[model samples]
Target: MTAVTKRFGQFTAVDNLSLDVPEGQIIGFLGPNGAGKSTSLRMGLGIMEPDSGSVELFGRAPNVQSLRRVGFLPEERGLYKKMTARDTISHFARLKGLSASDARARADELLEATELGEFSRSRISKLSKGMAQKVQILSTLAHRPDFLILDEPFSGLDPVNQQALENLIRAEHDRGATILFSTHVMEHAERLCDRIVMMARGRKVLDGTLKEAFASLGQGARISVEHGFDLAAALSPKGFEAIRTADVGHGETWRIELPPGREAQDALRAALEAGAPITGFAPEEARLRDVFVSLVGEADAAALEASLAEDGVA
Candidate 1:
């Protein structure tokens, strides 16, 4: 995107943010609730217009053909309450240019894939949220579009269904479909995403591999030695932010956040020098959750409001 901007009057939903999702890759469009994820997606899908900036969906203009070639599961879970899962999915597939027969066939295939085969004839209104969510996923993939966009796909599923959806996503990525999905569950993203794009107030905040994003955050590498671990004088001399100093039943841990340009080797030496039995020394590379919180957590504060004012200029 180049200078992408949008507003609901004075309330800017999206800012001049830029992003990229290459073919055959799954980009984790990640953010918290009301962080402009839905708004940006609506713009990307041409469901809404940007007040200023460009959005190119698949090298072509965002139009009917572009939308048809892309399958999307919106965040809002609204199904035809009276319609059976089978009819609902097939109907959407047919609308997306599938032949009636093809749509019916795909409905069965995805229903079974998502473990909703037994509920195919069940009306959406009669199914539980998890069941309805499965149907929504089936609808999104039934058309076999060139690209897939899933908005909070794991909202109302049990562990089993969540795994089913994840496997299906990996399968689609292996099949070479451009995939972009928004999610807040960090562990799933750590395992699934090739790259992650974090957003706040509709603007792209962080974009890179999970490791890269972590490295770019407040700390470099985190080191947690064994129980009774104390390098206070050793570590304090080197400027490590001691997050805590206590034994939490399970194990005595000292959560330390290293500063930028500062390597963990310094801490390693201190631990060794202090005779703190080295149990674990690894890149506590800030997790996706940590990086996200570090970058976007303060968006609700006055500091963020001022930052947004400067960033909103496009």
Candidate 2:
């Protein structure tokens, strides 16, 4: 996006946002409910145009040639209500400029890859949500496009199916597709993305690798001590911050957020030096979710919701 902005009268759907997507990497575009993620992608897909700024897919304009090289799976579940799973996928491939035979072959292969082999001939309307989701996924990738964009691809799937979806995304990444997707799930971003663009309020709050984005997270490895009360004083002598001391029926747990850059090993030694008996002392760092919440305060969530409910039809 180059100063991309989409507006509906006075409401701005995407506001002067720009982003860079590197080749052969999965970039997680993460945000809260209404953070312009879908709007930006829709503009890029050419289904909707940005009021200003431009979208480039595979270094070309948003025309048939560029679009044919790109695959998009929207957050919404979309498929022909009455088409068979096989035909639904094959039709999309045909639209992408594939010959009928080639389209059918690719659709079959993708359906099998998604474990929907037995349901290949079944009508999409008769399939369960999970199964239908699989067919929708196949439709997007049937052309074997060089770029893949997925919006909330994992939403509404069971753990097993989620893992299956993840594996498929990774396989495409390995085959050299530039995978870009918007997700509310932080763990998926942490695990699958090489880089992340975290947006809040129509602007990026964070954009970088997980390591670079989180380096600012205060140093303190959450460490647990065998004995609660006695450990605080002991650890403090060696300069360990024992922030939380809570009893969970079985034993007392202490959370230590260490000072910035404090080595976990050094902290453990210090705890031991203070004569703190340690049954377990593991350092816990701030997860991606923690960072996201910290970036988008609770107050912004309401406004974000309103932004998403705005019409994108124009």
Question: lDDT for each of the candidates?
Answer: 0.78, 0.79
Q: Write the per-residue lDDT of candidate 1 for residues 136-220, one digit (tens) a residue.
A: 8888878888899998887666678778889999998887788899876656688899899988777788889876786787764
lDDT for position 58 in model 1: 82
List the pairs of residues colliding in candidate 1.
Answer: none
Best by TM-score: 2
Model 2 worst lDDT run, 10 consecutive residues:
305-314
Off by over 4 Å in 2: 224-255, 259-266, 269-279, 301-314
RMSD (CA, Å), each prediction: 6.4, 4.7
* lDDT digits (tens) for residues 1-314 of candidate 2: 67788888988878888888888989999876678788888887888988888887667668877887899999888888889999999999999999999999988888887778899899988999888987888899889889999987877776788889899999999888999989776778888999998887667788888876676566555555554446667677666767666764545667775665576778788877777656667766667766766677886654444433441201
At residue 174, give the lDDT of candidate 2.
88
**Residue pairs with backbone overlap in model 2:** 219-258, 220-257, 220-258, 222-284
